[model samples]
Target: MTMRICALLATMMLLVGCATDDPDITVKHRVPHGSTVAVVMFQDCGIPNQADCAGSGAAAGSIFIRILSQKPGLHVASLPRPVAASAPLTDDAAVAYANKKGYRYVINGEVQDYYRTGHLALHSDRVAMSVRVLSVKDGQVLVTYTYQEDSKTHFASPDDMLEDMAKQLATSIVVEPKKQRQGDFMFYKGNGG
Candidate 1:
């Protein structure tokens, strides 16, 4: 009996030791403070019906921007609306617009497999969301993040569905801050002139 109890305690300690409070598991580009960012509404690459998620995508980007914006010197621009013209904001266009808006960096993504439910045949229902980001200037792929949540809801409303998706959207996108420019800062400083 004492041996069994000791084994159980050891197992519990091992589990506790493995636990972590670190929120961000993925590391992507990290932008520093005073850096401006413009986010384009993420496109839904999964299903046609889920394609036009500008409203929800914008909301999701807002959540992501909110967290990144919290960095002491960062300033984020409102996400750009999807343009119906020509090619839906070409990479060059996105960069130009962001620069025009005085943003030093920008965030744009593609979202897919996004869905929500109030109830499942089982006791718990699940929400799923996925997205990928691309860096326009260097054509560097940033990160792809996916999230799902399961919970019990007595009744699901449109708001409830949206809220769950937004929650997952916010938590899963754990982008690291871009590295600060290392060598001598060679750029001219704006003096409100």
Candidate 2:
């Protein structure tokens, strides 16, 4: 019985070691609280030969807008919908639009790849996307985030992955409050200053 338990534990450890690492999600900049943001249309950069596998850029942008709106300290603006095959707005144009709309930041994204593989009960969905945050004041890109995920599940869909990506992006942008100084002295009106 002891040998059997040790063997099982060793197998479990081997299996755990074989598991792949989670996808890397990076946030290059910090967005302060109470900032107004506009989410522009995402550009599709999927392979030309795999047009059918490509997802809608507009849909991705919409997902980001929806998720970012729910994040505390962010005010999302109502922006125009993106059309398929239409090129993303130039930086100048985007900055101009954001200025006109009173938004401090503009978000743009690109769907680098979107596809699924396998059939029946065996399938995996993959999504690769990049998001950028630009400042309206100077048209400078403040931060860029990129994520790629391949989820193997029987019932998972592309939309689900996209929503998850949006949630991840939203969570990455939230800025935590600065820690207070531990050595600072406290004063009260009734006590000596």
Candidate 3:
């Protein structure tokens, strides 16, 4: 019996090794380098007046921001939690807050949806996130990116799924920089170092 079990395990390992890797898999998007980013917790975008899943959504956004800060080549700034609150929560108050923090780019976000539904005979959890970026200098929107994911897990643990979502968000923000032409005077200082 032990011999038979070993044979079965070996076969399974071989089959797994034979599986093809995905060629189209990519995470990072194209973004300029050295841009100062201000990450804020996404506000609740769900129906108002009722206590929905706002806290969880906000928590997820916070985690996503933390993960994004750890990525390479991104100049992320730290703003206070209250200062990073929702648009309606802070209103025009965010301008002063950003100026005080010396951040050029402000990221405002909203968690539109998050839910876990059971399939006919199986169970799964779905997580969705949406975020908007605004240029505080001119009040122009930079971009808005939304991410969603669904996965199945055993009853004992769902941490893996959450980690996967965080990873996806982190990958999405890792982007390449754009090039710009500079005038001679821009670099021609008296003391060129």
Best by lDDT: 2
Task: Compute each candidate's TM-score over C-alphas.
Answer: 0.48, 0.70, 0.54
> Model 3, stretches more than 4 Å misplaced?
1-31, 44-54, 81-96, 116-123, 152-193
- RMSD for all candidates, in order, please: 11.1, 5.1, 9.5
- State residue 130's C-alpha deviation in candidate 2, in Å: 0.9
Tell me how far candidate 3 lies from the true structure as C-alpha RMSD in angstroms. 9.5
Give the per-residue lDDT digits (tens) of candidate 2, residues 106-131.
88777877765544645466677788
* Candidate 1 Cα deviation (angstroms), residue 166: 9.3
Q: Tell me the spans in candidate 1 whose CA falls farther than 4 Å from its real position.
A: 1-29, 49-54, 84-90, 119-193
lDDT of 1 by residue, 1-193 (tens): 6999999998886666444232222437544335565676654334456433435455555665665555456555676655631124555666566656666566665443344443544443333444444454664445444554434342443334446444443443333335533545578779969
Best by TM-score: 2
Assess the local accuracy of residue 30 in candidate 2 as a C-alpha lDDT between 0 and 100: 63
For model 3, what is the error of residue 60's alpha carbon versus the real structure, in angstroms, after optimal superposition?
Answer: 1.4
lDDT scores of the candidates, listed in order? 0.50, 0.70, 0.54
lDDT rank order? 2, 3, 1
Worst 10 residues of 1 by lDDT: 18-27
lDDT of 3 at 134: 57
